[model samples]
Target: MAATKVLVVDDSLTMRALISGALERIPNVEVVGLADGAEEARALVERLRPDVMTLDVEMPGISGLQYLAELMEVRPMPVIMFSTRTAAGAQDTVEALRLGAIECFPKPKVAVPAELEKIIAKLGRCIKAAKGATLRKAASPASHAILPQIEWNGRVLAIGGDAASTKTIFDLLGSFPANCPPTIVVQHLNEDVAAAMVGKLDMKVAARVVMAEDGMAIEQGSIYYAPPGEAHLVVDGSVPPRLRLLSRDPVAGARPSISVLFASLARSVGADTVGLRLNEGDDGTSGLDAMATSDGYCIKPNPAGGFELSKKTMTQAIIEPELARMVLKLCSR
Candidate 1:
């Protein structure tokens, strides 16, 4: 297999060196070139034609966001943004993701050797994943005149997605009306990014979207996003259900493991649960499989169903809850 070639783009020499050294340590990953700014990065892209790019969120000259918009317009490739763990940085990182960046990694505050190693390993994994990601020009949000209203039937919708499924998640949520079913999300993202994502989704979707908190009540027309780090989100087997945040060891190398969430849903909601797996691979396959065992509904993002958002018409297409309900009906059959 050919090594995944990567270009490091950062204004700081030290940061560039850090990213380059980290990428070089990963197996089958080659640091093809380093660029200080957007122009240099663009030049290097034309010259080296690396398979992936690690870009800084903020850069001199043409800003990283500006460069990203232009890059996606001309040469669409997988990009991972290196961001700072701050409010402003999180905002920019989310924008970058919207602009078609595959992943975003927040720089460690202390930059200790151990922390750096962890970041490096994660970055390498993201870079490798990026190679398989579908890159396209960013799409504008679709216009929906009428959001469908569905009856709340004591069922829960559990959605799990990977880095490549960010847009899909947004579109899925947009499909729901103000009185949509109860929903839980287990998207792989940093804590800061997750918080920012919840805020962003809350505004875009008619339902209330928030970060999962310990003992938070599960309500219809609300979406709870599992927080990143060491805690796993679980549903308490109580009446009018509540969410529990558990501090357990990571499962399948994911703290908020999709499998864990699915298993919990299977035990709690059982046949009433609808599990949607978007752009997730083996790490979440077992969980979705387990959900099937419990006779819950499981759905994969089918290209024909408008999960792919690259098409302008698809972006503007109305998302029907009836489509999901029909899938559940088929599962029962």
Candidate 2:
């Protein structure tokens, strides 16, 4: 297997060295080149043809977000962003992800040896996961134009995905009407990132988006995101189901596990549940299977395009505006 080549881009000399050094320590990764700014990074990218890139969010002259937008337009490739864990930085990081960056890592505050090691390990894993990830230009604003209204059928919509599915989630949710059915999302993210994502979605999407809180009622016309941290978000088997934050060990290596969420919905809501699996992995399959057993509708993206509903396939891009039309057909009263 060929090594995954990486380019490190940051204006700070120390950060450039630190990122390059960490990437070099990974077993199957090679730091092909390092650049201090957008111009140098562009030249290096043309020369090195790196498989992935580590980009700093804030750089002098052309900012990282600006550079990322340009790069996605001209030559799309996998990019991971590094940013400080500030309120503004978190929002910017979410924007970068929405713009096609594969992942975002928070820059270490103290740079202690122990914390650095952990960050390096996680960064290596992210780079490996990003090796063959598909990068596409951001969808045009027209793609998010509002969809026709539909009355909810008292069905709960549950969506689950990992980091790679952020854009799909944004696209799908953005097209939803302000009065769409009750929706719950479980995207694999850390606490800070999850909070930022919820904020971003609430601002941009027509539907109201909020982080799921313990004992919050799951109501129609609102979207709830499972907050990532010490608890798994589950639905209590109540008359108008309410969200429950259950503190337990991580299931399938994820807290707020998608499997846990789907299984809970299957048990509580039965056929009234609809599940969308966005990223393929073992993490969410078990719960999806449980949903299937309860006669709940299950949908996932087909690699060829469109979506798979139960065993049947629909041939249309899941991220297109058409998706809202299809989902409405499935869940409308």
Candidate 3:
């Protein structure tokens, strides 16, 4: 197979070299070109036509975020952002991801040799995964109207995803009504990114979004995000389901494993549970299978566009708004 071509864009010369050097060390990756700012980056993009790009979140003239927006409009392609882990940087990184960047990695602070190796290793894996990502312009949040309130049926909605599912999750939850079902989400993220995402979702979406806490009641109309760390979030099969933060080893390489959450929902809610898998990898397949075997409904991306159920019996693909409507109908019934 041909190497994955990459373009490195950053204002600092040292950073450009550092990133390019690290990428060159990885097998099956080629640094096609390096640019200092958006203008140079734009010209290089037209000339080099790289498969993926690594962009610094902040730049001198046209910011990385601004360039990303323009690029998505004209020629969409996979992009990964590099930013500091500061509070302000985290907010901007979240915005970048929402704008269609494949992933975001924090820039090295001290440039310590050991730490740089670790970060580069993770970035290499991200770059590899990004080559297969499907890129498209992000839809305006205003375009999706909030769904109408549905009758309460004691059902729960569970969502699981990875880095590629950021925008989808935002759009999906944004369309939900203010009093939608009690929803739980498990997205593979670091603590900083997870906190920023929760904050953004709480402010933008109609439903309340909060990080899950041990023994928290799974209430209606609220969305709980499983915090990333040593513990996995699971649902207790009680009279009224409650969230539990269980300290366990990472499952399928994710501490907040989607499989653990889905399996718990399958046991607790049975058919009352609705599971949506967005851009998730193989780790969640078993959990989704468990949900389906227990008679719970499962939805996954259809590849042609929109989403379809995991069951082969239903093959019709439905768009995001229709998905929200279907979830409402299913839970109400």
Best by TM-score: 3
- lDDT string for model 3 (16-50, tens) is 88889889999999999999999999999999999
What local distance difference test score does each model get? 0.77, 0.86, 0.87
List, residue by residue over 201-292, the lDDT tens digit for candidate 1. Answer: 88887889989989998898788999998898888788877899889998888889888888888888777787777765665678777777
Model 2 lDDT vs. the true structure?
0.86
The local distance difference test score of model 1 is 0.77
Task: Single out the weakest 10-residue window by summed lDDT for candidate 2.
Answer: 311-320
TM-score of each: 0.82, 0.93, 0.95
Task: List, residue by residue over 1-333, the lDDT tens digit for candidate 2.
Answer: 899999999998888877787778899999999999999999999999999999999998999999999999999999999998898888888888888888888887765445568678778888888888766778743468777778878889999998778887888888888889899999998778889899888988888999999999998779999988899999989887999999999999999899999999999999988898988777899999899889888887676666677722322345444666777667798
Clashes of 3: 0
Model 1 residue runs over 4 Å out of place are 108-115, 141-146, 301-333
**Pairs with backbone N, CA or C atoms under 3 Å apart (clashes), candidate 1:** none
* Cα RMSD, model 1: 5.5
Worst 10 residues of 3 by lDDT: 309-318
